[model samples]
Target chain A: MTPLDCVEGKGLACVRGGRTVFRDVGFRLARGEALVVEGPNGSGKTSLLRLVAGLLPAASGTLWVSGGDIVIEEREERGKLIGWLGHHDAVKPQLTAAELLRFFARLQGTRAQSVTAALERVGLSCAADLPCQYLSAGQKKRLALARLKLCGRPLWLLDEPLAALDADGKSLLLTMMREHLATGGLALVATHDPIDLEAARLQLA
Target chain B: MSAFAALLARDIRLAARAGGSAMLALGFFAAVVTLLPLGIGSEARLLASIAAGVLWIAAVLANLLTLDRLFQADYEDGSLDLFALSPLSLEGIAGAKIMAHWLTTGLPLTILSPLLAVLLHLPAAAYPALLVSLLTGTPAISAIGAVATALTVTVRRGGLLLPLIVLPLLTPVVIFGAGTVLASIDGLQNGGIWFLAAFAGVTLPLSPFVAAAALRLNLSE
Candidate 1:
């Protein structure tokens, strides 16, 4: 696992669908630091996080993670450093919650024990055996949270992490985010809603 | 279990759960083979003559119908991005998907084709050649078809567009596959089987990389 000391991008710019989303955006984040990206809809908050995650290549500029430059197919960077939570729920409706977590654990090259631990942590033990199709929207978001915690990556790129979450679900995520920061993990969360935590804010116009 | 094994197993299990693609392809293949007698003349000599081409064409189209399901489901459910994040390379994931696709569709078709050959009035002498040709040819079709399947994964109605792209690329496999059986009936040396094997050999390794590259393009878009 990479010990995250700092992630800083220089002059970041994003282009999508032949239009520039954001240009000349730059920042540096270190261990135990959080950056909450706030912006209006279509203002490139999600695009910014995706660019850092290497999902969307930056139109220009460099994103450096722990002193290593971001590359699209770098397995070590993607597998160990980045844990992404995009808008679309990645869980398969056909697989049971436990089965899905186990599959993800295997994909992350981690132990299956983390799957059970994360499920319990997220209060999903009761619904563990049920297929994801039966999961309500809130329960499905919790499942995605369980997967993020279970994977154990050092950097999180969360896009709208609180959408569809209940009060309990929101608190659970805040705790996870806190624990992640305390343990030297870095986070860049994009949302238009208020996050009641002490975080460095980057607002995109 | 290894990541590749898990992915391959999961894909096959999912296809089995989907419940229609593999079974539908089989039903379609059987119907085409069965209807051939009515469409053409019922003469035994004529049926025997065209049996090779007819059976090969049916199997190809039947297999083609399921190709769209290969990557679209993963792409839609957002697992494809998670797959890109895994320790396994995209190429490895593509290979696992294609293997699962072959196991469910191509492998079954190859096994069932010889049985359908009897309905087509295929001579007993041509049976072994038919089996060998399909065994070599099916993997090539799966591997090559996967490339086009991955390309159209982002398009909404790409399933309908699959045949347009795939049929032209896989025409050689069909030609070589049918040629192997025809050469067997004519009491001539069939070098076509060697060409069929070589096509499988070349495609099985190379196509996954091409498919993976296309999927990455789709993911970023």
Candidate 2:
């Protein structure tokens, strides 16, 4: 793990719908680290992750990710460096689980073989040929995580990663995340659920 | 496959599925063209004279039927958010979808126009002109409709607003498209086809940028 691998945001402020969502949010995480953001409802936990993912523009502060071979400064271009898991599963009902993963894998420019591996990793291999509309909600969350894994980005911006996850799914995700951190990847997770990970915590009220 | 091709293939597959709206557009186009003669009376000469215009109008409206969902479906499903995060530029994503819209709606409508024109007793001499004009002009319709769809994508129940914004912009396409067939019927050499082609030429290339800009606004907000 390169010590240079990390994400840093300083005095980050976000405005949405003509109102400030959050302000002066700052954090720095070096390689093999995770930051858990805890907050009440409407406290902008999701907004903070979105801000870092470059999906939302910072109204007041500077946000940048430094690590890997190249540094990303542009907000829009930072998506190339992030694997985002928002509240929405982003699954199409018409597509089978395997097809869904393959599509995302292709979009991520990952190898074709990774689709099968990701499905297996998420315990979705048996249902891989089944259409997503038939999959349960927790299964869908697993599918999203599999997509997150397929992205292979060094930084993960996961929003509510624990939502709708069964116990097995939860452990599976934690293990995958731990593996990610072990491999020099960092994560900023936004969640209400308390997780068991040796990580930094940031609270928003 | 590249992201553009992956998105394009998925969209086309969805449209081909049952209740995908692609067939709905084609069926609506056929029904409108078929029922028009019954409403306007069975005067063959009159039908022939207006066939180009009426079919063009039906084709335009039919192309519009499926447009509202172009970006709305992706946005609602949150695929669009992920797409924005992907390596593909928003402009490239917009372009691929515009092409998909053309493939499913515009291209199919073009193919079906002549069959419906037969019901209107359109002069066989103008058939090639009708095909060529639609081949050139309907792409502009798809392109322009894509931008309109993207602009209204964030609005709940935006389908009702789509035609109001799109149809007015399509006046020239309908005019030049129908005019090309009309001119062909009269054996006159007019610039109608070239104008139609030029309109498509301009809008097809420009819609991606305009739609991408709209998408950027909608996505960030």
Candidate 3:
């Protein structure tokens, strides 16, 4: 795994449905940093994160990630650096929670042990055998968190992550993010609520 | 397991679970083949004459029954976005999905065709040809459906349009598949099976790239 140290973008712009969502956006986020993206609905907060995650191609400009002497700009290479948590939890209703995590663990090339560990860390050990359809919204969000943690990527792109999370679940997520940052990982979280972390802020208008 | 294997296993497991698409397609295939003869009034020669065409059409329709949601479910549940971010390439994703679809739909339909053929009084001599033709031809159905499904994945209620887009493209597979079976019954020296195999061969390798391109376009939107 490449130890990603910094994510840099220059003159980034996004267009969807023939309308410009954001233009000339630029930022540099080093390891151990978090950038909370603040914006109103329809302001392209999700699009910006998606762009950085290599899910959405930027309408204009270049974005790259670097670790020491390794500078990466290709979309596939950049994708390897990101762990995404979108609004949808990405769970199949028929598969049990454990089964779901196991599949993602394999996809991400994470060890089998991480699946069990991540489930426990996310406090879903008991619900591991339950199909995702039976999981509550909070439980499902936590499952997504478990998957995010399992991927072991250096960068995270989270959109509305705190939605459907309980007070404890929210705190669990915050702690997970804190641990992720403390371990030289980077995060770009899009949220309307204030996050209790020492981090940079990017406000999208 | 590799990402491709994991995805294939997950999809197959999902299809084995309750409300799975595989069972739906299989049931639909069996139901239509069973009901059509009742409507057509099974005079032996008439039934045998049309059996190849009818079963081939039923299998195609059965295969189409599940195609619209093949990628849409993953796309809707955010799995597609995560899939995009994963180590697997989009082409690999498309291929894995196509394989899972075939295992669940095409292969099963092939297995069930003989049993359904009895209902239509399919000539005993044509059984092997029916099996061979379907086995070779249905992968192309899955392959082409993947491209069409990927193209329409983001359109709400795209299922209504899937057949319109896919059935026309599948005509060659149907014609060639049924032609091979019919020729075998008539003991004709025709090369329809070769043509059917050739169509599948071309489609199997090419659809993944096309589907991947369509998926990339849709995901970026």
Candidate 4:
């Protein structure tokens, strides 16, 4: 049941904009565990997450998720097992929260949830019918988090999940992470702030 | 059916709910077609000669206007990344998006071309030829536009650059499309439809893969 056993990376490097963001970076996460990637603004935390999520190629090493090696050949299969959320809330502004969640659920090949349940999980139940463009900043972040609840994937790659949250929103997210890990789901969250989790720290310098 | 249907349905619903860009594109197409005959002299022979080219050109422009939104909005909102990461390959997503684009922009343009043709004083017999050529050519427009849209997703001023990149590539389509209608008007239909069909067939399969690759490069950047 070791988290590292299920998720692992080795000698991973990423370059962007004619500069090497980080090189030889590596880490792992497992069920019932969380790995917090702490770094400064330009320290390649998001790049590392993208590499792990198989969104970008690693310059040098390999990433493995849930016992599957993340080579080019296994990318499609690996994608199904990873749920990634970046700092930019990717929700379509024209879509109601309900429609957005339903579309994403179908994309992930999962049954659509009661939008009520998903929205309520992120404290967005009252705004479920509202298009995302009209939601407040924190509300938008919550709407993005609601995707995590809807997809129910085992691995979560979150970049600064707590950036725009108020205190209550942060607490709600912390609780969500605990619940996720308690259920044998793993999370790799990249952030600057200290997250209240009994989690291992992975510093990307 | 296949996952392609699901992707198409989702995009069409998204497009429909978002103020119906397809119908709006058709409206633009009609407006452009109507204005051309007014701008130029309305002599019957002149209109008949230029009608197909004008209609196809207007349709291509209208399609380009809506093309930027094909990937730009999705990329801005982060749904493009999600689509990229889907179990469906990027090429599959590109194909679905192109189909949606054609359904929204191209199909309406083709449907409305005949109406515009009449207003432009085009010969009655040329209507069917114009329609057939548009049916074959507009998909190529959508497919080629997808490649440009994907390439310019991360670039600033992509809206302006879209047509600049795509229009040159659309030369063959315009040539064949306009040629087909003119040939019909001249009572010669031997090669135009086949040429149009061949252009569509070749571009449809090839453009999606190129678009997918371009999107991957843009995303990775």
Candidate 5:
């Protein structure tokens, strides 16, 4: 059940702030599989994620997602297929857990669910009604993960998904990843710590 | 259709939850209009003479109040990144945001213009033209503000810089917006409304592209 079976890159290079970040760097993640990108700060882990997500241009390379050209030319289509969570939590602090999920779901053209379903999936049902600004760090991360349950995109590009998670939260995310892969979904995660995934590892030095 | 609607809905919901900045903007517009008569002589004739100009200036200022939050909140929360990665073109997203901004800021201002106009003693006949011009022109202000919002997304003190970046570009909106009211007051049916409508037509389609490009650059940086 290869959800994403095609290669998606080309001798890609990126230069940032007048310095070369990485060159000829590339990898692929298919359904039931994952790619864990480990790197130190400023080593282009996030940049590579952005590049794959089509948020940033490669200084010099090509990207193909599921065999489709990765030119960001069709953003709405790409958005439906890929879910990207960057270093910063993108949740609007003023919105409640339920409101945030509904907002993203609507943007993705998916039907809005009871915020309870999303919050419960992420174990935040108790805090669903609280504004994001009031949530604890780990709780905020959980709310963001709830988006995955509601969004149902094929590819997940997570930058530091484990950043502020407690041990329990981290384990919950690992379980979620396994579930995602079991369903033939693909993931590309950039993290500083090693992630427990039965998938290939790409180290950026 | 759904995508645009979703974007608009999400933004409006967020704005509403955050305290209804639209009403605040309108209140600010009203306040600004009220204060002018105090600073300048309160003579009815003098107020009537500059009524259109004062309303237009207040409208622009009111719109600027929410401009900094347009992309900054999304950028901070990472929704901007998701938006950047979504299959929707950045241009479309920018356009959706501009529309949302107009709904939240411009629409309220337009509605309140009559009340402010009465306060300013604008000629009775000028009210319709003034309201119509505002309806057409404020969208242009929101669109132009998108570019400035994108440019200043990564800046530390974007709130202060927003006006600096947007005021110059907003000059056209001010000119045409104020010009139409003046024409209406003078009983001279001029082309100000046409010029304003055309300005919105051009900027509505084009400014989003500029904003999208700028967002791409800022996010890349």
Candidate 6:
């Protein structure tokens, strides 16, 4: 463990609609660390990821990022620090993969150089020019993966990060996760399957 | 590009290429205007009398045609999540979408309304009035509709509810918009235009924030 935590949550209580998904949940992660969140269906894996990403208002608790509480930080600045990958791949059916990545890259204020490299990293260079609707299930996942790398954010909140992937795609995700951790980034991933990585585990159920 | 400009430009391009908010709204507007004469048995004097009100109603309905889909596609494709989590505030995002909606749907409707007014026997003197009224009024449609859009963001089939919630709120705009042209035709002075401008002013500054707040509420739902 480092002397300081990258993300420190204390007594996070999450409620989706009328149901309380989790209560008094807390965890601390350091830079260059990946915390793998494991939970079965309806166990609040997705809810937890959202709460940390600042997408959902916690019923009660404080989530601190980079030693500063997220609530105190302006939403835009807090948003700039975290990258979220949800289940629904945000692939626009009408837009070509390159165009979508370029748009998100510009939206994220990421360098243009990262767009091409990110596409290539996800093995999407061949399919970058194709409209998103034409890409297969795996390719769409790759496109979402490219979006995560397109930003220069230090924190990643990924829900079910390995849902639809072939062996090669799975390996690509692993490589990307490794690279992100090596650069002192924090990735909090929600996954149902076991993956090879030296990551601290957070079990929801 | 900055997030604000990038979102605005991307949405406009998307509307032009794929979503076709322009074609749908304009086509609906034209069809409604075109059918008025046929349905009413081609009474020239009657058409002239009802021209401003009929065309104004058409404009409102036409604008409503595309309002449901404003946030539907983005919400479906998970882009809303990205937008919510981005460095862009929800208000900023809603503002960009309103701008884009005005460009593709409202601005075109404004430009075309004058021509349609002529088809409805609008007086030549009222052309400037119709044009200016539509130009000023449609932004109000977009601004108020942004709130409707955000509120309906989570509804699966928002078609019916979209108009139901919005039509009542926009009653004053429709009334004032038609009043502007009608006032011009009557050669009388009324504060119709000032009312429309004031309505737009209120809607433009306030609706985005209301829409953004609503979208946040829907986020957890």
- lDDT by residue for model 5 (A68-120), tens: 33333453455567877778777777778887887777776677865578789
Q: Give the alpha-carbon lDDT of every model.
A: 0.86, 0.89, 0.92, 0.83, 0.83, 0.85
Candidate whose DockQ is highest: 3
TM-score between candidate 2 and the true structure: 0.96
Which of the numbered candidates is closest to the native, going by highest TM-score?
3
The per-candidate count of clashes, in order, stands at 0, 0, 0, 1, 13, 0
lDDT of 4 by residue, A88-150 (tens): 888777778888888877776777756678888887888878887899888888988888777
- 4 or 6, greater by DockQ: 6
Ranking by DockQ: 3, 6, 2, 5, 4, 1
Worst 10 residues of 2 chain B by lDDT: B1-10
RMSD of 1: 2.3
Query: Candidate 6, after superposition: displacement of residue B98 in Å?
Result: 0.8
Which residue pairs in model 4 clash with each other?
A3-A30
Give the TM-score of candidate 2 (chain A): 0.95
Query: Whose DockQ is higher: candidate 2's or candidate 3's?
Result: 3
Q: Which candidate is the best by lDDT?
A: 3
TM-score of chain A of each: 0.94, 0.95, 0.97, 0.91, 0.91, 0.93
In CAPRI terms, where does candidate 3 land?
A: high
TM-score of chain B of each: 0.96, 0.98, 0.98, 0.94, 0.96, 0.97
> Order the candidates by lDDT, highest first — what do you get?
3, 2, 1, 6, 5, 4
TM-scores, all models, native as reference: 0.93, 0.96, 0.98, 0.94, 0.92, 0.95
- Candidate 1 or 6, higher TM-score? 6
The global Cα lDDT (0 to 1) of model 4 is: 0.83
At residue B127, what lDDT does model 3 achieve? 95
Q: Show model 2 residue runs off by greater than 4 Å.
A: A1-4, A68-70
